[model samples]
Target chain A: MSLILKGFGKVLKNKEILAPINLTIKVNEIVAIQADMEHMNAFLSLVEGKRSYITNEIMMNEQSLQGCEDLFIYRPDMGEYKRLTPEQCIQFWCDLYKVKINIDNVLALTELTHIRNKKNKHLTFSEKKRLQFARSLVQNTSIFIFQEPTYQLDLQSKQVFNRVLNEILKNGGIVIVFTSSLEEGVRMATKVFRLNSRGLQEVELGDEGEKEAEVKEDETDSLIENDTVYQRKFEKISAKSDDKYILFDPLEIDFVETRERQTILHVNNEEFYSTVSMKEIESKLIPYGFYRCHRSYLVNLQRVREVVVWSKNSYSLTLDKGNEQTVPLSKSRYGELKAFLNW
Target chain B: MNLRLIRVLLLKEIKDLIWNGQVAILFVTSILMILVFFTFNQLEFNLPGHSITMFKGIPTTLSFIVLLVTMYVQGNLMVEEKEQNTERLLGLIKVKYINVFISKAIVTYILSYLLFVLAMVIHGYSFENFITASFFTIPFFLMFLFLGTIIAEASSNTIEVSLYGWPIFIVYFVIEGLIYSSIESRFFYLFPNYHIERGFSLIEHGEFLAVFNYIYVPIIWMFIILFFLKKRRKNSKTILNSGFS
Candidate 1:
């Protein structure tokens, strides 16, 4: 489970772009790493060097299940295919994606045509974020190491990535997917480690998205039904139709449920602003799939389509419609968004 | 994965060598030349020495040409793998690189050697002294066959193997000629082919002994080439050897 990367640090020139410290991984776990192309390439250099600390043998293999004999088929050309062996699948997604470039008359390949260099061009931010989540998964080789495996790929090829990792884990193979997405990491990982400006923080799988949303709605119903101040604020906020967000002081908030959660209403009014607690509203909204990505807002999962960079310091999302709402995407919550988005 | 697999890979390499259109054509042409020489009992040569029995001329002249062509083919075996990404794929396998390299060399040598044997039999039958010529030639043929294989694999692939390996392989005999011509080195039995070729050539020339001596140079060349391969592997970084991210 422990990969001793000898002299790896010396070669990676830019260290500041790396995740915050305070992370630890165990055997047979999934930890996805999401980093820039340069960083991943450096990581690849280490892996190919038999840096895995395994024996010199490195077979490009897939699964070997009894019923699933022809587990994965790799297309080396448009119509040509090569079978994936048992070992390749238990490891990762490289088998399906990479096309091994070779020479015509000899075994030596051109150094210039190396595969790592080829991945650099044409990547969207979302794809890069997705990779960060994948990296975190790969690091979790602590709990589940892939046994003899195979790939079950469909057209477009990426559909089998998660299924393959899951099978490997089912048989017991550790996976670390270095990613930058919250949705991808959360979906694949049992336990996850995320990089925050506060340092490395770990998040336990809290609850299912639908169930959590339902719970929050029930809390909001109770607070609006019972509390005198909350009812007045709700009335006042409901009266003010056009205001996007109501300013509520934190000290005035009365959280009857989950401790650290906060709520920000999209209405500005004195009555509702004074009576309704941020935490109470958040707790109430939880049942509706509203999770706090920042201190000031509770985002509805169904409404959010994408987190696009608005500027250097902030990002905005064009929700379900043309609703252009800018929200602060913090480094602490960066990994979470990726997992939540499932990208 | 096992000895059986290794044997299969070895046989496959030999099959590849034997089936190659270029190698086959070169081999066939060498035999045809030998057949032509035997038909005329000798080609019109003004360079040196008498036009003795064509049976005697083959082990030297025809063997050198075939050895050169075979080595040329051997040197390019890995080139195709590099071009096709086969080496990277095969490198992932549990097999040893040395095993693959040696297997290819052995296969190339065997094919070249077999071609030489074919030419010998063809020439012997034409001369009407097949029994006597065949008797003296088999042992020498075996020795040269093994040596020719070694030399082909022994040289560096930077320049073409045929250009470098063949000339150097044949030069060992030419050096023997320079020494054998001198009274100072009348006891030139050191060259494996020198004595065998000379032994038969004195009474009646036969090219078999000279071909046998030609094999020694290549045998020594194989060991030398193996040494260089060992040095390269030893010097490279582990990252340099296999996967590079």
Candidate 2:
């Protein structure tokens, strides 16, 4: 059994947030993805069937997700409940799914049996997450999609989540977790995919040196051309210009700016419109020498040729591009900019 | 249209409504109000020839009680599921939207009617009055349930519902009461409560056709509300359009 997505794409408000992509998650495996909140919303909306995708096909239990009703389950990241006991929550799921569950086994598995009698609103934050985890366990589906499952979880509760994840994997079920933390993704996933506007791209999860050592010496230099994290396979960031699609390398872009809630990528004295938020763009291009010099501007550090001081507290970065394009520099980031440049 | 699925959802709604502390408190307060009305009737107005007409003129009082309790319990139930983010979980289950709506309405109607009957019993009314009140509240509370569900769907939380919904509903309710008792305006007759009161009056005066007038309006209102709600659910941007799960 497996959960599969072929050319899955989500578009909103006349712009595509997720490009058409392909992925396959099999039973007895866990796949984790790191994505921002908007991307998560778009993805979750598609998974829940609120919005349709373009050129997308999803299969669970060897059939389409729509055809196979009992194939997948979804759980939101937050854990506030309406005064339900842990046992009641499990029983409610059982009633909804039309299955008989041993509540004791579920509570024991999630280590929530002790609080089975306590009301949900009375539970602590961590306990509530465990109760949610236990609720998902009651549904016997092939694939489980959890949005930021480790959010607000304490260390001990995270250990409990890991244990529960292992149980699902051992029982031949696929678990897909969406998170923003790279550490959590690396710790939980057998395979990791970083979700961006372009699509899902597989990335290294375990020790960096171990994977590097496994690469052949002749191919190592070509695989990682620079010290930055941008690989050739994951370099192109998708954008649009005049009703046509365009792709720009993050390394080649001088800066990105936002105008009227629209993100515009600036490269080589040209502008391409983008749909992603500035914060999401910043996080994606941060490893490739992009710096958030101001709230509206994200400048490439490698393109910065000079720092112009407009006042005692104000500064701007002059790029090495045509006519030395200037971008605002926030007062708070001035110290980091100076320290990075050693000036 | 699966009966088994509807039954399961109904049972869950009943459980949630009964265990709610606010519902319990309102239930007890309603009983106390009935007792107070009973004690005042016995001690202060226990004169001859005052037995039949007593508590008959103010059927709206009982209607008001039922309205408040149903709105609080049913409306907040819908809003809470949305706020707690549990509606997303329900959407993945692939249950029919009609089943969820039917189950919730049935459960709300049953609980609200039971409490209305209990309050009437404590007030020590005659069988004729009891029968008239029962017939009046059936449509009365059902319309209230529809109104409450609409308000719940339009708002994000219980606080917003009370802040905006209660005033609009109360204004409509009080205006309907005025039109039923004192006004002869045609526009006021559009309020379902006006027709409900007129139906109860016809029942009181042995007009068998009251069934047609009162019954047809709420039935039509029910269909209209359900249609709009179904369209709303279909076009909703979030998964919090239904009350199930």
Q: Number of the top candidate by TM-score?
A: 2
Residue lDDT tens for model 2, B1-245: 77987888777777666568866776677666666655554554546755333333334545556566676667777677677777656655666655766777786676677766776666555677667667655656766676777777777887876766668657856775577553578886566666766775675565654545677676666667666765666666655334333
Residue A78, candidate 1: C-alpha displacement in angstroms: 17
Q: Each prediction's Cα lDDT score?
A: 0.41, 0.69
Instruction: Locate the minimum summed-lDDT window of 10 residues in model 1 chain B.
Output: B236-245
In the range A1-343, model 1's lDDT, one tens digit per residue, is 3222222221235644333233334445666543334544444333434433343222222211221111221112111001111122112222222223222111111111222222212222322222222322333222322211111212112223454455455655655554454333444455544543233455434345434655676687777667655432322221122565444433232211221232234321122322345555565556656666644345666666667542233343334444433333443455687797778
Q: What's the lDDT for residue B174 in model 1?
A: 73
Candidate 2 wrong stretches, greater than 4 Å: A12-14, A50-56, A60-62, A67-75, A78-80, A205-343, B36-58, B122-133, B176-195, B198-235, B238-245
Residues B1-245 of candidate 1 have per-residue lDDT tens digits of 24544564565455345435656766677666666656765545554665334334654544454445454556555343443243443443334555555566566556666665665566454452333444444444444433433443343342444455556566755764554453556455454446445534532443444434444544454455445555555654321132111
Candidate 1 lDDT (Cα, whole model)? 0.41
Q: What is the DockQ of candidate 2?
A: 0.32
Model 2 docking grade? acceptable
TM-score of each: 0.44, 0.69
Clashes of 1: 128
Cα distance off (Å), candidate 1, residue A147: 18
Top-DockQ candidate index: 2
